[model samples]
Target: MSTIDRRTLLIATGALACVGSAHGHGEPKHPNTGAPVAKEQQPWGIAGEARRATRTVDLRMLDSMRFVPDRLAVKLGQTLRLRIRNTGAVLHELVIGTPAALDEHAALMLRFPDMQHDEPWMAHVPPGKTGEIVWTFNRAGEFAFACLIAGHYQAGMAGRISVRAA
Candidate 1:
């Protein structure tokens, strides 16, 4: 997965506070291959070893364009499985990352408009289908998980992840 460190996020946000065009932010590129990366993962968290889930939270994507419970609390280092279901009529995806990266990617989506991408931190689901994500909250900070499906995000398809110290 393409992960963005704190420094990159700060610089990007500091430049694009208004969520304007991502000029000078450089093309979103894959970290390893130097190839263009799409919707890169922010440095907030890593791909978890989800062999087993300590707990499970079922978050449903509704036609209202929102997650059932918009806020989740997890202790740092807690690995949990997210059972995601799409109850809407369109495609939806749950993407976990820093708010900065999410906003940047959302802006990018507005530009490309048809970019389809996925990563370990993401779960794509279609209407009436269910998807799953195993995530470990390794860091004790505020992160986010949102549906980056073009207008879905702007329509309020998002949630907050609060990882308190374990």
Candidate 2:
């Protein structure tokens, strides 16, 4: 008889779920490596072309589980280039999505700490590294961005995006 420990079983289950499901922010990367999947429009906005970015915002993720300039405001129809620098000693990510979506995604991360997904609205950076995400806010509403790595979100590594009507 073979016995599978609870933790191992749970991790295996979580890995399968992450790879098989296309839920929340985006699809999981195959074998945890590759180019990100295609772009899609969320309620907050769609992936913006780099050429269309009207402004660039720089943010830093710290080991304290915080983002500098956590609050951002932009006009509708404007595209933004987010330049993210991870000053933390561990991996950090910036995933832009609706608040509800971000919450759900964060929960998933808690379950599968090794889960890896990629999207245009997301940037995963290692320690002392930088990444970028270009997004266009077509809808006028509130959005959010967070580091959904395990306990980061719960630690309040999040920020708000306000897209005002033009």
Candidate 3:
């Protein structure tokens, strides 16, 4: 899988926020490719390559701003299904990307807290609810997953992802 330019990703995410707000967050376009992820006719990004999960990771989001087992490990080329449960009494999200990208996105969410959309690498989980994000770790790198709900990130709601060799 190929990486998306940081600038391009940020621009796409910003556009997604704008379009999502205008469309009432009802499934706008995939920002990476400017098409619906449901269309199955386009590629979103490197993180968009979801396949049958070879591993299942169970994580818990806490109200105190923490992710249980915050540091996750996956082999390169391995597909995973992240099963996230919100044990918190509020909304939380899991967005996977580089630290810089996540930091930028967290700031964006702080500005537009109500903005919403579905992306291959994002999973929004409500209180007492569960969500899943299927993804393939194609590259070897240290990445991140975070909850970008307004003050959440500042409250220390984030995790590390280590994708190593196959």
Candidate 4:
């Protein structure tokens, strides 16, 4: 055979050897490429599994304002997963507190020049992004959640979370 043919044959043989070794290791097979799939790329194949394990909640922010759901009733002593999405132009936060606690917290937050709300339990979510929070409420009471970012709470970004005994 010519030198070019020999070089091509050697390259093909090397590729086939790599494929055979990968197969022996029980590697994932690429659909169209017919090659061993990388670990990171395997997520594409198990995307549904990953999505099934996560719980998501959509939230929106607009003009430095946050519009959240009015009421959220959860079971006491149960872990709750929350996903807050900011679909607004400005930054926002999700603050959790009791109604009385929020009242005091909101007052305290206003004292700081940069602080918008007073609640200690807060999640800051930037524009066009989502933030996740996992919380367990042991007490059954009327708890409030709001965005204490300056005027966000006043702009109606607050909601009530009623935890009832399960």
Candidate 5:
């Protein structure tokens, strides 16, 4: 008999899961209400309410593994409604986090390509579809957003966010 390690098991099962699972592409949700969580804090900021969004920033994800307007600037404490459109034929996602955090997550993604974890700071947009992430820049610092989808981030599907202190 042959023994399959965890990594091998996961990869084998992932293929089946990917085929059978329903992929949801959006912010973290409440288990009871299925509503987007609006108040988780991070080094960059916190989840924000859509109604409280003071401004809207439109972003486009391309098959070239890049984000349109790959850089952004915002004032500390301002709430932004990031409207992301996937103009690519493949799925792309916008995940906001510190560089280190993103790097760690991206590494994990490479190992478990079919991981379905969702957070308030990420949006997984499918081909020709749109998604949104409302966030508040409560902390003033540099951050980043990337698509941690298997080979996506490694291919440089990333962007920067600069939050200037008010």
Candidate 6:
């Protein structure tokens, strides 16, 4: 298997292990009422309130390319739910950052022993699979979204996001 496939398998296995062993410490008891709490009240319960709010964006990845929207517009201070689907034969990443930051990260990403696992802003999605990124863009500026998979960016697999002032 390729390096990307190996890393992806490891990540998926780890996530599965986490989900399987996420039970809270014993049964939870309500603080004020001093009563045994429902399963939903457990700290690690899946039905509990979310830690953060979210938004959703659907994107697609083609072979050696990112089919991200040409210009994504959003307001500052909004949490983003970026869902990227990979329809490509090879691995891809969807990273969001300022132009300068992208340039810096791209430089660092190239130096990783395995280019597939180098970028901190990148998430691995196998071909025909989907992945998500929950992010908050706090600054108002023009940010670029790209797939920094080796020569993917140079192949024009990049787009821009405009953050309007609140």
Query: Top TM-score: which candidate number?
Result: 5
Quote the positional error of residue 57 for candidate 4 in Å: 4.1
Better of 5 and 6 by lDDT: 5
Query: Candidate 3 local accuracy as lDDT?
Result: 0.73
The global Cα lDDT (0 to 1) of model 4 is 0.52
- Give lDDT: candidate 5, residue 5: 29
If the candidates were sorted by their lDDT against the true structure, best first, what order would they fall in? 5, 2, 3, 1, 6, 4
- Lowest summed lDDT across 10 adjacent residues in model 6 is found at 40-49
Off by over 4 Å in 3: 1-4, 17-51
> Could you give candidate 2's per-residue lDDT for residues 78-103 as a string of tens digits?
99999999898887889887787778
Model 3, span 1-166: residue lDDT tens = 2355465565666768576333222232333444445422112225433456788899999999999989998887787888999898787888887787788777877788766656668787778978877777777888889988789899999999988886
TM-score of each: 0.74, 0.79, 0.79, 0.59, 0.80, 0.62
C-alpha positional error of residue 62 in candidate 2 after TM-score superposition, expressed in Å: 0.5
For candidate 4, the 10 contiguous residues with the lowest summed lDDT are: 39-48
Tell me how far the alpha carbon of residue 49 in candidate 5 is from the true structure, in angstroms, after superposition: 0.8
Tens-digit lDDT string for candidate 6 (1-166): 3454345445633553455422221222112243322221111011211235355778888884757565677777666767788898776777665565555545545654143232223455667878665556666767787876567777888888887777
Which candidate should be chosen as best, given lDDT against the real structure? 5
Which candidate do you rate higher for lDDT, 2 or 4?
2
Clashes (backbone N, CA, C under 3 Å), per candidate, total 2, 0, 0, 5, 0, 1
Q: Which candidate would rank higher by TM-score, 1 or 2?
A: 2
Would you list the clashing residue pairs of candidate 3? none
RMSD of 4: 22.0
Q: For residues 1-166, could you state the per-residue lDDT of candidate 5 as single tens digits?
A: 1132233334434553564333443333223345657475667798998899999999999999999989999999999999999999888899998787777677877887766655578888888888889999999988999999889999999999999977
lDDT against true structure, model 2: 0.79
